[model samples]
Target: MSLTDVIEGTRQATAADPANAQVSFSVANTLVPGTATAVEVRVRDHRFAVDEPAPLGGTDTAANPVEYALAALGSCQVITYQFWAAKLGIPLEQVKVTVDGDLDLHGFFGFADTRPGFTDVRITVELAGPADAADYEKLKQQVDEHCPVLDLFRNPTPTSTTLAQLTG
Candidate 1:
C-alpha cells in the first residue's frame, strides 16, 4: 500500500510487541552449472536471479551480490528517512540517494590481505524538503544511527549456518 500505511502498521506492531519486536525473513537459492554464473533466489512470493559481471565469469545478466548489498543498504537508508520523517512530523518532500563502494579484488582472488567486501562505502543523500540544512543534517544523523543495514555493515552480528541435504 502506501508509506503511511507502513508507518501506521509499524506503530501498531511495535505497540503490540513492545518487548520483542523481532521478525525473521528467509530466502532460498539454487545454482546449476551453466555458461554463466547465476543463482535463482526465491524470497517470499518473488523470484529473481543474481549474476556476476562479465569479467567475474557471468554474462552480466543481472546485478551481482555485492551490488545487491549496496542497493539494500541504500534502500534501507531511504526507508529510515521516510519512517523517521513521518514519525517526527517533518515535511519531507523527496529523498534521493546514491551509494557507492570500493573493492579490492586481491582478497577475492586470494592474493593480498585485503578484505573481500567493499573496503569503503559512501552514501550521499540529496533531500528536497522544506526543512533547512540543519534539520536535514540532524535527520541524516538519525538515519545513520538508526538504519538497520548500516548497523549490520558497521558492526558485527553473530550468525550461524546450518546445512541439510535432500535425498532423491
Candidate 2:
C-alpha cells in the first residue's frame, strides 16, 4: 500500500476507536523435545519453530531464542520507520535494519552473574529516501518514541511467568 493509504488507515482507526491505539499481543510455545532444540511457536493463527544452532548444542535448524529477540527488535524498528514516516510526512523510499546482540557465554551457562540476555545490542538503520537529514532525524525521533518493542527494550516492563498443567 502507499504511504498515504497507511496514513489514512491509521487516522481512521485511531479516530474510530482510540482505545484500539493500545493493544495487546499473545504468543505461545510448546516444546518439541523430540528434536535437540526445537519448539513449536504459536502466535495468533500462525505456527512456526524456534531452534538453536549446532554450536550451542542443538542442530542449526532455526534461529535461536536470542536471535529471535534481536529480530523482533529489528522488525519493530522497520514497522516504526514506515509508520512514523507516514504520520510525520517523511519520504522514505527504502529502509533496512541490521541488528546485532552481544552475549556472554558465562551468563547463559550460569557461570557468572552476568546478564543472561544481551549485554548490549546495536541496530543500524539504512534508508533510501528523498527526505533531508533533518527530516530523517525528526522521523527517527518520533519512531524512537512510538516503537513498542523499542520501548520494551529501553524501559523495564514488569513481566511474570506462570506455570499450569494442561490435560489433553
Candidate 3:
C-alpha cells in the first residue's frame, strides 16, 4: 500500500471515530548506578543510553537528553516534509532537516534565574525536487502546521510528575 493510502485510511478512521485519533506514547527511563549522569531508556522494544558530557560530570558514554531532543526535532521535520510533500503532490526527491537549540546551564544548576531547557530552537529544511519555490513553501507551511513535534516545541504542554518508592 502507498503512503497516501495509509494517510487517507487513518483520516477516514479518525473521522469515523474521533477516539481513533486519540493515542498515547510512553518511554521508560532508569538512572544507571555508578555513573554521574547516565540513563537507560526503553521505548517499546528499543533501548538506548543517555548520558551527559564530562563537563556535566558524566563519562560521555552516549548523547545527552538535550542532544536527543534536537535529533527528535530534526528527524520529525524530515518525516513531516516527506509526508506533506507526498500528500500535497509536490514531487519531492529529497528532504533534510537541521535543528539547533540554545541552552543555559544557570537554570539547571540553580545558580541564576534562567530557563533550564532550550531557550530557542532553529530548524532548516532542505529539499531537492522539481517543485517550484512557492509549492515548496506551501509544503513547509503545511508541515509546520501539522508536525506534532514542532507543536510540542512551539507550545507548552500540560505535564505532571509523581514519585513512587520501592523498598527492597
Per-residue lDDT over 14-131 for candidate 3, one digit per residue giving the tens place of the 0 to 100 score? 9999999999999999889887799999999999999999999998999999999999989999988888887988899999888989999999999999989998898988999999
RMSD of each: 2.0, 1.9, 1.0
Q: Of the candidates numbered 2 and 3, which has the greater TM-score value?
A: 3
lDDT of 1 at 168: 68
Candidate 2: where are CA atoms >4 Å away? 1-9, 12-17
| Tens-digit per-residue lDDT, 19-119, candidate 1 | 54678899987774665579888999999989899999987878989999999999999999998787666779999878999999999998998889889
Worst 10 residues of 1 by lDDT: 28-37
Q: Could you tell me the C-alpha RMSD of candidate 1 in Å?
A: 2.0
lDDT of 1 at 88: 67
List candidate 1 stretches off by more than 4 Å: 1-5, 32-36, 166-168
Error of 2 at 124 (Å): 0.6
| Lowest-sum lDDT 10-residue window in model 3 | 159-168
TM-score of 1: 0.89
- What lDDT is obtained when candidate 1 is compared to the true structure? 0.87
Most TM-score-accurate candidate: 3
Model 3 scores what on Cα lDDT?
Answer: 0.92
